[model samples]
Target: MSTSRFLPALRVMLALQTVALLLQAITAGLLLSTPGGRGLHNASAGVVLVTALLYLVVAILVWRPGGGSPRAVAPAVAMVVLVLAQAMLGALHMKALHVPLGVLMFGGSLVQLVQVLLARRAVAA
Candidate 1:
């Protein structure tokens, strides 16, 4: 399969994950300040996890030998695992780890998105 064929789908995955990450951040702020924000925060956590998983799936598809993608597979998988851990930390009320890990995940996802975009540019050029 052509690598370019997967580009659009990969881009969509990146877009969804970006939005989910933003929502997750907003919900985190809400959770800290609003009494009723817990529900929204939890719901947004689920969104982040779900989108990360979906994004990973796409990454794996692109990583398949046939996909010809330059993106690394390990980081995508790690992000999924980290998100799961983040959820567990939140559920167990491990703020010490949860808060820091959330920040890490935010940075990681943005980095991954940039990598994908850079790969696309490199391929096009």
Candidate 2:
């Protein structure tokens, strides 16, 4: 019930999200670079799938405004949207869209990281 308690959970979420995001981003990169390669697309999809699942868990932890402030909610929503888009676009696997999709995932991940850092700083103070 204490704000302090949430700090550790938030930190863990941050680390997990960062790892998952990076993996997914890497997968996207791999796919984007090898559009004609089915093997790479499959591998990328696998990574994206796993990372998305992990991201879901992280999303839950930060689902609500822990301190009753809506500061992190926007970025969280953005993350969710990007996650869905990434999954859908990835499933489609259209070669032309690979780069754009990759960019979206990468940008979303960076935003998530920024949000996590901000949340951590809020807790630290």
Q: Which candidate is the best by lDDT?
A: 1
lDDT of 1 by residue, 6-102 (tens): 6667778877887788788888899889997899999998888888888877777776744655455677688889988988899999999999888
Let me know the TM-score candidate 2 reaches against the reference structure: 0.56
What are the lDDT figures for the candidates, one per model? Answer: 0.79, 0.57
Off by over 4 Å in 1: 1-4, 69-71
Model 2 weakest 10-residue run by lDDT = 1-10
TM-score of each: 0.88, 0.56
- Over 8-80, each residue of candidate 2 has an lDDT whose tens digit, in order, gives 5545554665566666556546655776555655665565555555555445444454443344445555655
Q: With candidate 2 superimposed using the best TM-score fit, by how many Å does residue 61's alpha carbon deviate from the native?
A: 5.6
| TM-score of structure candidate 1 | 0.88
The candidate maximizing TM-score is 1
Residue 76 alpha-carbon offset, candidate 2, angstroms? 1.9
